[model samples]
Target: MVTTRVTWDSLPDSIRRDIEARTGPLSSVEPVSSGFNSELAVVLRSADGATFVKGLRADHPRVWTQNREKAVNPHVRPVTAALRWSIDNDEWNLLAFEHTPGRHIDYSPGSLDLAKFVQSLRTLQELPCPDIELKLAEKRWASYTDSPELFAGDYVLHTEWSPSNVLVGDAALFVDWAWATRGAAWIDPACWVVWLIASGHSPQDAESWAAQIPSWNDAPADAVAAFAAAQAAMWSAIAEADPEPWIKDMAAAAQRWSESRRIGARSQTAR
Candidate 1:
């Protein structure tokens, strides 16, 4: 569910002062509306430069996500906006990132952004999972599959592939590390396959595009099949609970990809 956003002026005076003290007296404040997770999302400008701030009330249920992003930031350098500073007071838990300039990526078939997007995935695929507190992929999907161990690995996984989480400028930059996980290197590309399908790629074509990431090629066939099935089930449940058009579309895409993988498995068995 989307959190109700708070305006810049709604913050307590003491909180505003604390932020300005770190940002050098904000000259301008613009609320950012693109992301859904943060109750406080804005761009602050000061004499020095601009900073992007996102936060939740200290007592918010998901406030732990703030700490996850902070712990993961140092490991995910130029591919993500640099973390400038963070604040945790009685009122709020906030993070400030260098203001990165870019538009969200277009995942539509034939768009030029595909190559850059895949390259960014390749960069992420090469990074080893940092020894930090991250949820294990197996545990995350345990309810969806009997063989959750198939998802285990030593690589960092950016499991969410929504177009909005990626920014395209001089290069593709991934944002929102709150859901980052430790999983098989191929799982990231596997996750992207669903979004690619939703963006008008055939299941086969989506898998082909995912093939651009070398790790995708190394994936065990059974593991990939299990992951695909799990995604289909997971998205279907989400769609059923919400019934939003976009959510239904994602559910359909995941189902299509899962069926395609099942067919491929049967074909191999028949041979």
Candidate 2:
């Protein structure tokens, strides 16, 4: 078994000290998923109850990323109903939020858990973010990826829609505020469906999951060619930059999406 090391001692002491000051001495620290950008730590405090602390790791330009969140969070505060606040170490950037309680559904496409994923993503799109740097969401995904029949216009920007990133308890709470922006709302769900289809799930299963989103009642109609293109561009970068096994999985799914689009288009023309 390959172990991913995430320990409280691995974080900067100065950062922990600052958290202690604010939350009033954390009693227990449980490291959660450190996905792509930050290390998620659930801190239980004596007086303050529970809080989430995301310690920014060095590699992925976190200071600028969190700074972007710092700028738009206030605007989205009322909309998302999720708190996003950044702390500065005068050298590094970390984000602290009120730990929303929920179950992190470990879902892939075709699972009933996909409903939570779609609802959470749509809610994020509904969030008012006039101050966000939309280009920040682009992340130059299209340039690296190749597909002759490109369909990149079916959604707002895809986020950390993977099952682990989504927490479902009282509600679907999307924790990662990074890589969020606007486009066609369907793009993210299409990406999720790709996850389902690739995970030994049939097209029927994919349709059931996609239909869970009322906006996507006609699942095939909702699966626009543009959505496939957008997903291909969005995920190809992760495949290149990270050594994570899931990235490889996404890359293959992206290519399959391209092929599926081509075949579907051709089948329609044949009629």
Candidate 3:
């Protein structure tokens, strides 16, 4: 569910003027009904074309999220919509992006999009982490992990795994880099495993799909288990706080994944 939203007409006249100055006159605005952040998220259609814009007020507590998205855009442009411009002045802050034409990815078992998604992850894994400072996975999950060092790695990660965050077009495009993190390359695929499980795949099936990404395959089992436990705790807290259906489902999926990992480790120990 959209946590907050603002329509084009509701924006201050000054903000509207600033936006029009960047693009041509806005002929139409289409609000996108996805994402929990962003006070505004809409496609502004002009004589030239449509540009997607999502933003929040400067005073908002999570305003840093916009900065995070802007900073990582260039690094992930190969698999993301192009960032055209940004307005980060006194009152309003916003970003305009190349209006990507695509629908949310379908992560069901045997979906054709799986190959493209995996390729995107592989390509992303190869890029040098951008110089921009970001929240490290180890740091972000320090409280949840048995040892923060278990989360260490040098790979950049797009930590969100909601299907809505991905778009299927000429390629599987990952949108919303707001939560991008610097950590083990395998973390993103590990996060996706939870979503895959939430989307109806068994925990075993989810791991199989994740193993297709070489980093995930090469990752140490203990490190992955550490992440699984942390993720389960994180989702459980979110579910308890809000109790949204999606949140609860994902929490359950994460718990299931965590349990499976524990069971597998025991089996190996038994042998």
Model 3: per-residue lDDT, tens digit, 81-160? 99999999878689999998998999988888888889888888888899898889889999887777877788779989
Q: Write the per-residue lDDT of candidate 2 for residues 109-165, one digit (tens) a residue.
A: 445666666666566556544644654323334454353223233334544566556
Count of clashes in candidate 1: 0
The global Cα lDDT (0 to 1) of model 3 is 0.90
**Number of clashing residue pairs, candidate 3:** 0
> Which clashing pairs does model 2 show?
103-168, 109-196, 151-226, 155-183, 155-184, 155-185, 156-183, 156-184
C-alpha lDDT values of all predictions: 0.93, 0.58, 0.90
Candidate achieving higher lDDT, 1 or 2: 1
Ordered from best to worst TM-score, the candidate numbers read: 1, 3, 2
Q: Alpha carbon lDDT of residue 51, candidate 1?
A: 99
lDDT of 2: 0.58
Global fold similarity of model 3 (TM-score): 0.98
C-alpha-based local distance difference test score of model 1: 0.93
lDDT for each residue of candidate 1 in 1-271, tens digit (9 for 90 to 100): 5789999999999989999999997789998998779999999999989999999999999999999999999998858999999999889999999999899999999989999999888998777689999989999999999899999999988898888899999899999999999989999999999999999999999999999999999999999999999999999999989898889999999999999999999999999
